[model samples]
Target chain A: MKITNVKSYLVEDIVKPFTWQVDRPGSGDGRDPRKNFSCVMVLDTDEGISGYAKGPKGRIMMDLVERRFSSDLIGMNPLNSEKIWEKCWDTDRLEEYPLYAMAMVDIAVWDIKGKKAGLPVYKLLGGYRDEIPAYASTTSYDTLEEYRDVVEASLSAGYPSIKLHLRYRDVKTNAKLCEKVREWVGDDFSLTLDASGLWNYTDSLWFGRVLEELKFEWYEEPMREFELESYKKLCDKLDIPILAAECSDGSHWNAAEFIRRDACDIMRTSTHYKGGFTGGMKVGHVAEAFGMKAEVHGGGHNNLHLCLALPNNTYYEDLVIDVEDIEAKGQGQLKFENGMYSFKEQVAGVGIEYDHDELETISIQKYEKF
Target chain B: MKITNVKSYLVEDIVKPFTWQVDRPGSGDGRDPRKNFSCVMVLDTDEGISGYAKGPKGRIMMDLVERRFSSDLIGMNPLNSEKIWEKCWDTDRLEEYPLYAMAMVDIAVWDIKGKKAGLPVYKLLGGYRDEIPAYASTTSYDTLEEYRDVVEASLSAGYPSIKLHLRYRDVKTNAKLCEKVREWVGDDFSLTLDASGLWNYTDSLWFGRVLEELKFEWYEEPMREFELESYKKLCDKLDIPILAAECSDGSHWNAAEFIRRDACDIMRTSTHYKGGFTGGMKVGHVAEAFGMKAEVHGGGHNNLHLCLALPNNTYYEDLVIDVEDIEAKGQGQLKFENGMYSFKEQVAGVGIEYDHDELETISIQKYEKF
Candidate 1:
């Protein structure tokens, strides 16, 4: 019942090199596909129910838990998720910050809770639906033809929707690309655009109008998340649902300001950024109270289960290269069948099993604290 | 020039037991005289001009540096104060948070800068003033007479001003105590009230009115710092200046929102909370651009020098005990005379020299990472 120890493993190249048809807008600018790494955290408890979670980029988060958070967690009951989350916030007193570290521990604690209860994390959380619709969250691409091909392939593979991480720089060119994707997918398929907070107010407005014309489902992170006045203006001027507050300052309390200001249509909450699942749940509740949908920022089994628990969230953004490619690489990646993703029935907690052999091979460093 | 190793020394009871006439407003309710602990950090560079700082609440922060931050610092240049501060921010991506840990290192970096330049830290920070007026920041008292006596004693001691950390509950009693102190201190003597964020909207309004009637200098932390709407209302309605945004979510950018909302008259920025001297300086600059005064929350030679470097800051709230009491315990405390405190000519960097014997006696934990 007590958290006895916490271990962090830094795994490198766990993910195979996968290229986006379009370059990731405004980052690395023509460099090779940036490699992927995992910081895996395993929480060991006295009662023999170990919890697991993925930490932030390697040694940083692992060191955070061991040095700063371990003492607080060591003697406490693993079920006290709320207290553990609050302790992480109080440790720094920075408005529920150090969220990356908090999430690693919190997700693990939740994993413990699910395991102890003999229920999936989703069932423990309110389990609104057994399955949620999956949308293909596409990476950026170079040409319109590439985007068109990807969308066509995704639709052909039975994905109900696609969300684009569009190109940076030119608003007109990005708008043209969105139009091409919309035309390629046709009217029945849902499409959304994530510009990665690339545009300013005027450009965001210009591009938003284009999405509105094409009946795109939503336009996400069009402007800086903190630009409340601009977000309000964009929300007023545009017809597309604005998904924002993804990387809010600290806790959900910080994100609530966006809702308070009437800034965006859909609120973005995640275990990674908004403290952890505890923080994410609070954000979802806050958005729900305002009659707004709180969208999980990206896809993962953890996020999908959280979506299932919260009635307010509507879709799962299944992130990938191609389903076959991910499955081929094996171990860490989830298997996608026609875009629907779920945890195995026997898999409790976060439910995603680590490929231990692959994890060990890629691991560059490891730290354990009790 | 490169940081070779980082050492954290956890010193216990370095601060002597000094009781306030009353308790601190809302914290440590009814506990015995609180023990003082120091988390001292020493940044050893390859070139041998080392830097030092005191971190947040004992071993917690010291361990943070040893376990998480040392690796990042080992090969880093001590002169890259700005870059070092940013890297700390990037470590968590929590809005330049974990300020407590960052401050401990940054103060040392600034110290290094001052030593390397053979100029005091203030001179490096733009040296707006060689000396700053020190105000007696009083702890809570049990009775109005105790407060009246303390104010009278502080004034008689040649202090220019006194700020009160008033009782936790009962707005009316706190207002009455404020009125009594104001009447006793008479006109032209500055008095500020720190309610310790003990009041809500109505009570804050009620007590703020009393301070206004008495011509108090400022009201500090009347309500929760995050209550932007309440702060805006309080600022608009009250004649006395509202000092707030002390522990904002992410560095000063989070605090800047208070200015953007026109929420408070004076801004609170400190090395401990606003990342470090680097972040504190940024907050000070932001407040300066708005034509508002940014006040350092507490006194320390480190903070005083930071204040001296920033033009917008006006005074230092010398915290906890009388300067004499502070100096009596030894090492890090500054000397105060005739309402002013300044660094000694020989004191370089942060200008604080540890009482090595006292530090050694109190040392309970030590961590070093290279």
Candidate 2:
């Protein structure tokens, strides 16, 4: 069916704020918590079906959609996702359309396609599995003790593995913490590290050596994504799989470079950052072709769909900040039980739930284009 | 239909040999002409339909199919091209299956798929056009006068554009020749240069500046394909489109790296070097996504199908070693008339004509696996 209208809602304070512990001394007391706002987009079609997705949480994302994409999206068939994706990328050389904006449109269009086909998004993408093991991915915390407690709590809450996002600048302390946590979690537990693209070559080497000794599952983004040469060196010097290209610009295109250079062992992909399912799957297939894995970067219904569909992807990431907050919110349709995340059976589309009343009350701005 | 058997034939002296002019001192009189042998691959299915494709011209390609790939092909469905392609790449990390070997299987599979569907391969690939403009691509020649004669002959033979494969090591002489040819052809005719990945960085820059001044359509592989950083610098320095990654490994993956780094303005792709139709299409889509052209690298029925199917690819290449030779062996099925290559209407599969009696006469080795 043809898309009749495109709508975006800028909602405030819908998600709980989450903070990251600071590593650099003068970079403020701690990293600011994520803004508890979201840009929710909806595409209304002539068949009376609406597709929904969450875009990057801000006015900028909404403004980009309204000014640059909404008009172009009108009168297009939602089922022609590839054509629409190409249309959006037609101006990429100059516009450099942010991944999130493209992701929002593509994800919404796939949602419409799935609903029409009477299948979930993952099935439409060629499903690999209904359940996937999940890792507890954490925001950086202040102390070693805090890390230990979160690791214990994550295990108790049914997570099979955990990935530590440690203080950016303090390599030594992070290494020590990794060693201590490995001891606490014991030998069989799957533990990995995400340095958040913060280390220099020498520092990354030093830190990577420690991870190797500790038998960490993977060493992630120790250097900035653009430092491909450095990443190549790291891959050569260290045995640990280097997971990279999480926030890099060119999506599958950039990920292909990392693979070609032997720079990254695991590729980071998400509907939120990699132009939704279409771009994410391309990266996944490219990695798979090279005998590498493309890991889902975040925890959400969209990412859950991807984790299920991608054969090369091993684990779904369940973001854990405060244990209490995670317990209260509860993971949506993707239920975590027995240390695995499983999709609810027979659900069509992306299977994301929307609270219309909450969305209406929290929306600060609404834009509709026909 | 289930693939029942895979067969390979090594046939000798099936093609006319053509020489390449040498550029470096003591590199021998001229580069040895291409071997006159060819490896023909056929996939026999249970449904009594057989698919055909020409592999890289040698016994090694036949050996690769027999020793590594034939067993895997026995029970596969020929229509499941993507699955078979992925199965081949399953060992890419260690085995590093050469592009031509993979291309042979993929192209043969597509042939079976198209014949089964009663359509041309281009139509199965989502047909973009029935015809594409053709460029006469010349082999390197010793003298400037010989190059001038070939360019004149190509124009008379219904070619609108011509790409010069020039003496690689002599940049100054090549530059002078480019200027002379441009002046002879006038400003409107499309003239481009291919250096065959021979120049060093400094020489590449100097030659590129001359090409830019002469307004060549593109400067191709001025430096080695592995020297990506040098290509990136050349792209930044030259305003003319840089066509690259023609002989590079990794197919769409490597092509993606060039696009991501802005190393080339146009990408070089062909079924013979990329992984056949599937791989060529992926590279085409990747370039299209970035608003770049993916030029077909060589001439043949396979490359012709790609030129018609890919929206961003502009011209089909018609390799012209000598005017007399090309005139005697006219392009097959893909007719070149009035400056364009057009496919025959209602032809199924790749529409390649094979002389079975000649193949039998020239066959030196035959292999079959069931």
Best by TM-score: 1
Residue-level lDDT of model 1, residues A1-370, one tens digit each, is: 7898877787654343444323221221111234444578877888888888885345455546555566667788889999888667655442233566678878889999998998888888788887777787776666667666667677766778888876446888887787777778788778888876676899999888888899988889886565676798899887789999886555676666787778899999887777778888898999999999998877776787777788899887776465453343214444456566555354677786666566667678777774
Full-model lDDT for every candidate: 0.72, 0.78
Residue B279 in candidate 1 has what lDDT? 85
Clashes of each: 6, 0
Candidate 2 chain A weakest ten by summed lDDT: A23-32
Candidate 2 on A1-370: residue-level lDDT in tens?
A: 8999988888754344554535221111111233444578888999988888886434545755665568768999999999888667543322334577788889999999998988999999969998999888887777878777788888888788899987547787787788899999999989999887676789999999999999999998886565676788899988889999887656777777678778888999888777899989998998999999999898788898999999999999987877775564344556778778877567778877567677677789888885
Off by over 4 Å in 2: A1-370, B21-34, B329-331, B353-361
State the local distance difference test value for candidate 1: 0.72
The residue-by-residue lDDT of candidate 1 on B1-370, one tens digit each, is 8888887788654343444323121222112234444688888888778788886455446545654577668798988999888667654432233566778878888888877887788787778888788788887656677666667667766678889886546887777787788778887789888876666899999988888899999999887565677798999998899999886656676666788889999999888778778888898999999999999977776788877888988887776454354343214456567777776455667876566566666678777774
DockQ, all models:
0.14, 0.01
Top candidate (lDDT):
2
Q: Each candidate's fnat, in order?
A: 0.11, 0.00
Docking class of 2: incorrect
- Candidate 2 structure quality by residue, lDDT tens digits, B72-96: 6889999899999876754332233
- Model 2, position A323, has a per-residue lDDT of 71
